[model samples]
Target chain A: NTSELASHELASHELASHDRTTFNPTTEHLTFAARVAWRNAARCVGRGYWPALAVRDLRHISEPQQVFRELQRHLRQAWNGGRIRSTISVFGPGVRILNDQLIRYAGYPDGLGDPQNRRLTAELTALGWSPPVQRSDFDVLPVAIETGGRTQLFEWQADDVQEVAIVHPEVGDLGLRWHALPVISNMELRFAGLTYACAPFNGWYMETEIGARNLADQGRYDRLPELAQRLGLDTARERSLWRDRALVELNRAVLHSFDAAGVRLDDHHSLTRQFVAFEERERAAGRRVNGQWDWLIPPLSPATTPVWARSYREDRELTPGFFHSRRSAF
Target chain B: NTSELASHELASHELASHDRTTFNPTTEHLTFAARVAWRNAARCVGRGYWPALAVRDLRHISEPQQVFRELQRHLRQAWNGGRIRSTISVFGPGVRILNDQLIRYAGYPDGLGDPQNRRLTAELTALGWSPPVQRSDFDVLPVAIETGGRTQLFEWQADDVQEVAIVHPEVGDLGLRWHALPVISNMELRFAGLTYACAPFNGWYMETEIGARNLADQGRYDRLPELAQRLGLDTARERSLWRDRALVELNRAVLHSFDAAGVRLDDHHSLTRQFVAFEERERAAGRRVNGQWDWLIPPLSPATTPVWARSYREDRELTPGFFHSRRSAF
Candidate 1:
């Protein structure tokens, strides 16, 4: 039964087995738990697809090198020739991934690449990972995994990853691109009184996540001012709304590029609508949908979305959920 | 000293005076209290000008007709011939204003103008107020004041009110205009354990309040879709970013119109910068700035502003503040 087991009962089982690290579940239960965890993710806007998550039970693999190999395989399989499928690869306890995400761009000290990854890049560099001769903005960072007090580094072949080169429908090319699959590696999945610390999971990209936030945010790519300049907008005046205009254009480019590449990506409008429908379905099934209002609303033109007007239960104590790992990469 | 007094101590003074309705303070205390109330308004983004607020002490005026006359004068004086001044006119206790705002457009059953005021419009209509034969969208509603259980309706002369007709910088007239002053009449101003029930306060417009919310919200004017059609934008595709583009243009129109009309208006950028400076100054003075982040961030291109990155104390129990009246108009 996939029901709540008392923590004390689980503790007694751990004592009987003499192995606190191992808490095994049936394959069916593990898959169902992973799906339920996705459904319970309050900050995710794509909960409608939680039922479709394919759970890979790789708990038998404890070696660092083997776990890294499975991660590479997870990337390629999840890519699925760009009809990207939501997937998760679960490893045993004591298996730790040092990257926040399975795939992220390396950031240099001189600020050439993604600034969000600067600390992680430095950590990987200190751990004896070598960079390419020429560094670019989209250089993929090497995957680092630790198991049984030993750590190892692994790199993916270019064919394993899928990336969309952003080009606006109206403004041909501004030379921007983002990875298709976003496998969050640093979250622990808790289910039935047990924690799976290396359950790297992913869904398809939401266009605004890449456009309105990743590239458009002042701290990240900080591309709006440059994009405004390229578009010959009046950047000197805030009344001109040059930043808003540039944001829209940049988001448009991301959507157009994803569509051209046939990579599955959701625009904010469709995704929010889907989220509302999911909310309704959960309510119909006698389940309360908990959500953070700020996270649920899209960053661009938030008031236009249905979620902007709707309020959900802000505080929830849900079990069988994905939570931030105690051991964070940064 | 304008320090916090015990509520029981004020109650004891009320018993000794045999007048519970009146709590008189020095003129200087009243002015300072009004200024501090503006500063402590957590939702306000223009608190940088809190010190410059012109407080008019009309506490002695308690008759209904006399209150109406003073309100009319407050509007004209605060308008200041387009260079609007932040002003407040305080009336004694037991005085109630039926209108939420001193100047707001009436909404007809056919949804002609300001659906937010529909209930108030019906209430006023029932109270023997007459609508114009040609009820245009810009028709101002009559102000209703109640004192001694006698409610009187008063209308402002056309010269007393200042309105800005919205026109775009590039695109010409769209037949949209808004009143210059926003004097919130229903909220109570409390200071030193006494409540001023009819203290109307005025502040100049933030263009986003007009452009992004009042006109752009779906339940409000919903002018964006029509504006987008008129601007020749493709509305079929959500990825075209039609809403974002239209929002920017509408905000641009508001900014351009106010500047052209010589009206005092704050664009979101300059106002947010001013808010950040106010926050710093408050910190330097050893006072925590309490703020609601949702209200502080402008509706248009919010992440482009400095307030987007800052955090503030969300909860506080401060005296000498303006609060929503328990006796609401609607």
Candidate 2:
């Protein structure tokens, strides 16, 4: 989390030339957010601020002058050619306005908590885009785009919120596709029941996928003695099975994240008809004629996504700081 | 520094804190100034932007449009709402703009850097109200504010610039002082020589000062051990002066730092004068009784500060898909 991210790490650091500039997620990013959260907690504790009353009387100040005076000090510093470490709210009593006002003052629209602020994040952690339809520690059901065969998957993890994208060698138009609901704090995640798993071909595989890592990157194929035993029977078949296994594992991960998000893609009538037509075409036209799709596009989650709420206002509030801290393991 | 001040470590830090809060100066307050300086650096590096060259490229797109069109997007999740972290820029060939619109857009500032910014930095830094200003390595000055004989003194130093002040502690009235022309840059620091010197108690004395700790919830006191011993012993009268040589050195250090910060007294009037009347008043005033000060204040530096410019920039311009790695230190 940074200026817009509400990330504490981004706020209170002195990145000198002699100092290192690398991100340690939990230590740096999370710790900073924790600091800000603590600051917020201090304000809450000092003024008896809590979940129920946080929205109303957000201000613990007596009159508007108390807040405005603080704002004036920060503004004066900024105008006096002073540098503001506002990212971490270090200006102290100086920052006493709504997030929108801060952004408006700084030449941007509402950031962080706004439903439409995408510029404040790195990946698709925003609930509106590839929002997580459902999730369990092990499985997730998500509505993602089917650009060819590859897709990006979003997840809400303890350490970071991020999207895991699987880019097939020949698929360049791939991206995650999703259907978003307004907001939901508590929702059940659906599993794909995917026990299917895949393993990638190792260097010793006698036969490997054409688009797979070549000998240049994998080194000589002869180096893996253990895997060479596959040649005795059918090395090509073994390699194929391994690759499929790898895909299966990746698919399961995607599902796990989707299930965690708890918002699934809705039924698209035209898409349903197109799916049938596309299946017929694939069968009649043959999977690969002239550099067409090399693999089958998995069926989109059943048009019947699990029943879930479209929005919830009082239950969960999505903030850039917390979301950025415990982001997905992309 | 253990983030704690020893009862006899140093007292200049407190003076610096006072200066920082009041924006008046005399002696350089090391610890307080250092904290302010570092914070200033953060402000400089992380300063919020002003609406410079403004360009409304065609129409702004929302996260939904981005998902539908496969365009780049930025957004926050339903967690941490205030984090800011997205940057999406498009270049020439990739963008389509109308000729007339392009002309209009040209009026907006294209970049963040502005000449006014640098000049203002130069001024704040000189006043010891900003970062640890240095040029090359030689111009780095250690700032500290000292107090003695009930008078406050501000000290600005380096291999180049030198300035000192003596003033009443309460009303902040200025008195006897000496100054040197200011020159900035690391190269100038090698020549740091200007010093604060005076007569009477100026030779040596122990002093204690207290301020906030790292936790920001506690207070700490630091004492100048060396200053205490020097004033305690009349070494010239003692036959064992040689055996106490170590004490001499420590006392000398204490005296040096102590003298540089001048004095802190409640009255603006002098205790020493040329005639018997002055001597009588001095004896009458003696040393007004006092106790320890336990509160929070920031330090200040003189109006002359050194300059620092980085040697590397282009090497670390994070590009698309390229953000600096956050290290554990961050």
Candidate 3:
């Protein structure tokens, strides 16, 4: 128990660069550390199920092609016929995945698709990755993996990716959709003083992440104005609250569509409640739950959620955790 | 210019408690300090009009009875026939207002009114302040002031307090209403090594303050459930977004009613834009605007505002500002 406590205390601090050479954790230790890392992810509201995370240790495979193949396997396995599984694929040092996420739609030059991915889309285009002859907003980008001073692009076979078409129960179709899996590939997984530069990890999507932010944010999809127009709401006056109505409907669509599609997507309300449960479980286990309150509270009707009323200690030093990478593979 | 720079620099730090005894400021200095304190208030989104703030130097008054009378005068002058004015009355040390605000609705024994004022209402009742013969949700509370180890209650004359009946343009009447003037009475104004224990400040209402929070917050009036029911929204399903729709309608009602009543009320959109202008003006004058982001963004559709995209330094160390008092008067 004392040794476990000491290990946890050590993991709570960022290991200096010199510690990396001396640290050599066993495969079991690596797996447990990875799970603890997921547990330590402060910004994730879906961390209630962190203990059930499947950490695929691909640290032995150093070749880019092998890494790409494993990543493809990861996508298919995690998809699990729409019943999405929480997963992470940890690769060895010097292996980097350029894509911010395993699957992201291309953002075209003319302000089409996800504007957040415009720079990355342009970069992929420069790397000899050809776009489809007919450009669409939903063109999935190729995963660019870098290894041994060389980089290669790998495309996910169409069958590997699953996307849900957003449809409101009351408002009907508005032709909006988002990918099922959200495997974040850019962040480094640091545990036991060792860093995995290519550790792509994911849980199922929270509806608000897609609805209120990704689609509704002005800088992202910028969908509210169009949604408002479609709903025949008055956009002339801010007091009319056309944007607020559109946002709620959009979120409703995301939740309803995901449910109808039988995909494992979490609604903000249910997810926030689970987060509260997660906090209680952590407290019972004698562990402090550090969280960034801004990230914890959903963007939609935030005050309705319990997280809005509570303050959180935003301690980012917790390890066996994911961190921003020092450099991009691109 | 050098002396002015020195004075500005000196005003930026919290003067130690020891300095309070030695501090002696002229009326002109006190007036300027009050305005600057408003400008430096981190949580006030309406502070774009800080320069126009009328500071009444009632600092000479020490009696509780006279303080109560002056506060009533402050309320009426601030009302200005529904075209509210930003005003602050600075009373000298040992003068403390027990009420959190100059005007707030009382919460009865049965949870009919504002629950936030329940404890205060009970305390006032214990001090011999009588409730109305017929209890209502919008009963204006009597002001309690403490001076020289004695507490006294003062009631505002009927015409002095201007209240707007909240009625939606489309949703029509739900029988909700709020007072026009928001005179915060409890906070201590710290400036020039001095603390004004009873400085009550007034600003016009921002519709969201009444609609999205005071009425809609679960701990307050909790109007969303009733409003949602009135609007015939599906309450059983979270995906129906009943609370969100009700919130927007409630906010719309507040804005529409205030406009119809010819009361000065700032909508979130316009106020946030003004806040941006305030930030620009402060920056141009070589001053960093410190703000609490949570307080700055409106609770309703927060991401829709310009303030949502931005981050603010939440420095509480800034002086010539309002601070939470060490102890409550009650």
Kindly report the fnat of each predicted structure, to 2 decimals: 0.62, 0.00, 0.65
- Model 3 lDDT, residue B196, Cα: 85
The regions of model 2 sitting more than 4 angstroms off are A1-330, B2-27, B30-34, B40-330
Ranking by DockQ: 3, 1, 2
Per-residue C-alpha lDDT of model 1 across residues A1-330, encoded as one tens digit per residue: 223234334533543565435656767667877887888888899999987899999989878878878988899889999999999999987888889998889988998889999999999999898889988999998888988777788888888778889898877888888999999999899866788889999999888889988898877888999889989999998778788889888988998999999999998888999999999888886778878776787778777788877876654457678988667855
lDDT at A296, model 2:
14
lDDT, candidate 2, A1-330, per-residue tens: 134344423444422222333422323433343333322221111111111111111123323344334333433332222111121112111121211112210111222122222332223234234323442111222212112233333222322212223222222212322112111111111111101010000010101111111110122111112222222222343212222222222233233333344422211222233434433453463431111111111111111111010111121221211121121121
DockQ score of candidate 3? 0.63
Question: Over the stretch B1-330, how does candidate 2's per-residue lDDT look in tens digits?
Answer: 233234112334444345333433222222232222221221122111111111111123322223213111111110012222211112111121111100000010222122212333343345454333232111222222112222121223222222234232222322222221111111100001111110000000111111011001111111112222433533343221211222222222322332445422110001111112322332464512111111100110000001010111222221111121231011
Name the docking class for model 2: incorrect
Which candidate number would show the highest DockQ if scored against the true structure?
3
Q: Per-residue lDDT of A124-242 in model 3, one digit per residue for the tens?
A: 88887998989887889998888877778888898878998988787788788999999998998886557888899988998888999899999999899999998999899876778
TM-scores for all predictions: 0.92, 0.15, 0.93
* Tens-digit lDDT track of model 3 for B1-330: 365455555544433323677767666667668888888888999989987888898988979888888887898888888888899999877889889998889998899889999999999999998889999999988988898888888898898788989898877988888989888988999876667888999999898899988998999989999989989998998767788888888988998899998999998888898999999989988989989988888888788788988888877967788988879743
Candidate 2 local lDDT, residue B233? 39
lDDT of 3 at A132: 92
Q: Candidate 3 at residue B133, lDDT?
A: 91
Global lDDT of model 3: 0.85
- Please provide, for model 1 over B1-330, each residue's C-alpha lDDT reduced to its tens digit, 9 standing for 90 to 100: 223334334533543565435646766667877888888998999999987899999889888888888988898899888889999999876789989899999988898988888888898898888999999887899998987787788888898778999998888998999999999998888866778889999999999999998889988888999999988998999877788889889998999999999999999889999999999988886788979887888877677789877876665457578888777855
Chain B TM, every candidate: 0.92, 0.14, 0.93
